[model samples]
Structures are given as C-alpha cells and as structure tokens.
Target: MFELLKQPWHWAVSGTLIGLIVPLLLILGNKKFGISSSFRHICASCFPGNVKFFKYEWKKEIWNLFFVGGIIIGAFIATVFLTDPANSIRIAPDTAGILNSYGITDFSSLMPVQLFNWSNLFSIKGLVFFVIGGFLVGFGTRYAGGCTSGHSIMGLANLQKASLIATLFFMAGGFFSTNILIPLIFKYLQ
Candidate 1:
C-alpha cells in the first residue's frame, strides 16, 4: 500500500476520483468546491463585522476549510515521505532543451531551484514571478468569481454559463502567459 502510494497513479483513476467529488458534493447540498472560496469563508468567519463581504453565514462552508487543511497536510506528507530523491523530476529531453533555452537548466527538483530559491526571492525576476504574478492570480480569481478548479470543475459540472465563459478565458490566459509572457520574462528578466 505504501509503495503503491509513492508511485504515480493513472490519469483516469485521478480523473474519476475528481469527477466523483462533484456529484458527491451536490448530493451533500454543497455546490462549491475550490481553494479560493476558503479564503472568503475564513474572512467571513473571522472578521464578520469588518466587511460586508465577510458578513455571510460562513459556518455553512466550514467543511471547505478542513478540505484545504487536508490538501496542505497531504502535500507536506507527500513531499517529506513519499518523494524519491533519485526520481524527483523527469523532464523529457525535448522539453528540457526548450526549458534550457529559457535559462532554466535545473530540473532536479519539482520546480526549478534557479527560479524558486530563497536568494532569487529578493531578485527582480523573483519579485515579478512571485509577487506580481501572485497578485495577478489573486485579482484574477476574485474577478472571475472563482479559481480554475471552481469554474472548470464544479461550475461546469452544474452546467453554468458563467463557468463556461470563465473557463474559456482561463484557457486563453494560460496559453498567452505560457507562450508569450513567460518566455519574455525569462528572456529579458533572468
């Protein structure tokens, strides 16, 4: 069982599990599913009197907080225990060549240490990637009324029109950022 946990599962297995979550949540009278809404729930529960946005009955969504907590704990456990140092990240030679062209040679870790290291955090490139990019993600999530998981999974499962539009834009933004913005940033900033 432990060895099985360490190995990568098939995509269909993961996809089926994720797909089951939608109907399960719906049957349980909870339509929403995503990490972003937990922030709103936290704000509503903690600072109800401070903002109108935080004045809702957040207790109804308390399960989401636990779900987020589980995700964090699971990630920590996987990183610390399940990970194999020898087989950490395996990028294809073609993909590695493309990444190398963008000044990212380190494929030893899940993320490029050259880009995500503590020393880089204080650099201009790091500020743009971490700080500015983080701010944009936060703003975009709020603007879109949810994150990719929420819009793409739950909303689409419920057949909501707004979710379809949001998912389309999300795909477009992802494509543009990956193809154009990230390359430009790597070319000039790094």
Candidate 2:
C-alpha cells in the first residue's frame, strides 16, 4: 500500500495541493505554512519554560496543531487503505535497480521491513555517514536561514529575494550533489 505512494505523479500532485493550501492558510489567517514550525510547536508542548527552543505563544494556535495532527493521520490512512495491489510491479526501474544493488532483489521481500535494525543502520560506516550528512543538512538550513521548502515555496510565493537566491542555490546544489558527488561517493564505498 505504501509502495503506490512512491510514484512521482503522486508526489507531484500532493506537492501542488500543498502549494494550493499554503495560499489558503495565508489568506485565512496570514500564516506562512511550513513543516519546521511544527517542530517548534512540539518543542513548546514538552518544555514550556525553556525560552530558547520552546519560545512561542503556541497556546493560541491549538487549532493549527490539530490540523497538523490530521495531516499525519490522513497519511497513515492513505498508506494502509489506499495502496494499490499492483504497486510492487509499478515500481520504477531505477528504484528497483537501486534496491537490488542493496541486496533487496525481490520487491515482495521489501515489505514489513524492520525499523530499528541497529546493526545495519548504526554500523560504524553508517553512523559516520549519517553524522556527516546530518551535519551538512543542518549547516545548509542554518546558512540559508530556513529549509528549502520554506524559502522556495512560501518565501518565493511572497516575492522574497533572499528566498529566490537561496532556492536557486538549493536547486543547483541538489543537482550537483545527486548527479555527481553522490554517485562518486557510492561507487567508492561499493
């Protein structure tokens, strides 16, 4: 069921709908909708006294929090109930080949995969790579003053110049890293 959602068109449609909703959110309440803000909301709930991280008048936006919860619940329902039976066969050749390279040769073998497989996920090699990758992502987000979607979708929609430059750099950086650096690094590791 979750496999059907791996489709490109499915993501494209969802992204377009999200973009549509951003304007509605702005018009209805003048809120710049984003995912990062949700983290802040959660933090405020856990540590209301901490002024550094949990610094928000989050109590006023309880309804917005409910909307976020709805999004999470809706995603679970879509994954479990709306997934197509032919999803495994509908997988892209590139994705299938990538999975095969990782020793996951069978599409049927992919499902019911373990989540906390620490030996594989937290191996010496895996952990170091994750630390470096996570650091780079955090650095990028900080250096840009916000995440890609926040600056690109919401910022550009409001005609913010900083966001435009950041969005272009983000796109260029993604293209170079994915098309060049990622393959080089993966080949060396293999």
Candidate 3:
C-alpha cells in the first residue's frame, strides 16, 4: 500500500476526483469550491479592522478554511511519509538537454538548487523567479477575482462566461511565460 502510494497514479484518477468536487460542493451546501477566497477569510477572521474588503461575515465561509487546512495537512503527509527517497525527477532527454544548456543540471529535487536555494534568494534570477513572479501571481489572482483552480475548474464547471474568459487568458499567459518570458529571463537575467 505504501509502495502504491509512492508511485505516481494515473492523471485521470486525480482528475476525476477534482472533477467530482464541483458537484459534491454544490450538493453538500451550495458551497463554491475555491482556494483563493480562503486568504480573504483568514484576513477577516484575524484582522477584522477598518478594511472594508475583509469586513464581510467571513464566518459563513469557515468551511473554506477547513478545506484549505486539509490541503496543507495532506501536503505535509505526502512530503514526509509518502515520498520515495530513491525516486527522482525523470525529465525527457531533449528537455534535460535544454535545461542543461540553461545551467540547471540539478534534478535531484523538485526545484533545482541553482535557482531555489537561500544563497540565490537575493540574486536577480531568484528575485525574478520568486519575488516578482509571486507578486504577479497574487496580483493576477486578485485582478481576475480568482486563481486558476477557482476560475478554470469551479467557475467553468458552473458554465460561467467570466470564468471561460479568465481561463483563456490564463492559458495564454502560461504559454507566453513558458515559451518566451522564461527563456529570456534565463538567458539575460541569469
């Protein structure tokens, strides 16, 4: 059972579970499935000051907090218990060669130490990858009114036009970043 858990499952297995969540949440209590709004709930619950945005009755959405908590707990369990020490990332030869060209040969962990370690945190590469990228993601999530899972999964599941638009933009942005922005950053910034 532990060996099975350590092995990568078929994408369809998890995809089906994720797909089921929309109807399950709706069936349970007409609850919307989203992770981004939990941040607002945390702000409201912790700092209920004069911030008009977080002034709502966030207690009504307390279940969302529990849902997010479950995700965190699940991650901890998977990382500490389910992970196989011998298993390493398996990249395609061509992909690995391209990455090697970019001076990112370390494939021992999920993130390459060259780009993700504390020593590189203050460097231009790290700043662009972590700080700038994080800010853009946060800003995009706020501006779009939801994160990728919220808009692409829950919103689209509900047949929302706004969500369809948001998901399209999300795909386009991802393509642009992967094909253009990332290469430029690695080449010029690194």
Candidate 4:
C-alpha cells in the first residue's frame, strides 16, 4: 500500500476523482466547487471592513474556508510523508533543453534553486516571475470570476457558457506564456 502510494497515479485515476467532486458537492449541499472565492471569505472574516464587496454574509460560505484548509493540510501531508527522497522530479528533454539555455541546469527539486532562492527573489527575473506574475494572476483570477480549477472543472460540469470562454482564454494564455513570454523574460531579465 505504501509503495503504491509512493508511485505517481495515472491522470485517468486523478481525473475521475476530480470529476466526482462536482456531483458530490452538489448532492451534499449544492455547494459550488471553487478555490479563488476562499481568499475573499478569509479577508471578509478577518478584516470585517466597510468595503461593499466584502460586506456580504461570508459565514454562509464557511465551508469554502474549510475546503481550502483541507487542501493546505493535504499538501503538507503529501510533502512530508508521501515524498520519496530517492525519486527526483523528471523534466522532459525539450523542457530540460530550454531551461539549460536559461542557465537553469539544476533539476534536483520541484523548483530549481537558481530561480527560486532568496538572492534571485530580489533580482530582475525573480521580480518578474514572483511579484509581477503574482499580481497578474490575482487580477486575472478576479477578472475571470474564478480560477482554472473552478472554470475548467465545476463550471464546465455545470455547462456554464462563461466558464467555457474563461477556460479557453486560460489555455491560450498559458500557451502564450510558455512559448513567448517566458523566453522573453529569460532573455531580457536573466
């Protein structure tokens, strides 16, 4: 059982489980499955500000907070207990080549130390990758009404047209970032 847990699960297995979540959430209490709204719930609960946006009854959505907490806890458990020290992350040869060109040869961990270390955090590349990228993601999430998981999974399952459009844009943006923006950032910033 332990050995089976250590090995990577096929996408079909994971996909099936994720697919079940929508129906489960609906049947359980008609709760919408989304992650991005949890941040707003947290802010509303903690700050209790006069902002019109945060003035709603966030308590009704308390389950979303628990869902996010479960995700964090599950991540911690997976990282600490399920990780196999001997198994290093494998990068595709094409991806390894592109990273090599950017002087990122280290693939020992999930994130290469070259890009993720403290020193780089203050550098141009790090500023673009972390600060600018984070801000854009936050803005995009709000503008899109929800995150990728929410739109691509729950929204699509519910046959929402807006979710379909948002998911299409998400895929396009990801493609553009990988093929164009990343190279430009690496070329200019690094």
Steric collisions counted per model: 0, 0, 0, 0
Model 3: lowest-lDDT 10 consecutive positions = 83-92
Best-performing candidate as measured by TM-score: 4
lDDT of each: 0.84, 0.67, 0.87, 0.87
lDDT of 3 by residue, 27-75 (tens): 9999888888887788889987898988998989999999999999998
Of 1 and 3, the candidate ranking higher by lDDT: 3
**Model 2: pairs clashing at backbone N, Cα or C within 3 Å:** none
User: Which regions in candidate 3 have their CA more than 4 angstroms from the true location?
Assistant: 46-51
* RMSD from true fold, candidate 2: 4.9
Task: Give the CA lDDT, 0 to 100, for residue 168 in model 2.
Answer: 91
Candidate 1 lDDT tens digits, 54-91: 88878888889988898999889989888777767677
lDDT of 2 at 112: 17
Per-residue lDDT value at 147 in model 2: 73
lDDT of 3: 0.87
TM-score of each: 0.86, 0.65, 0.87, 0.91
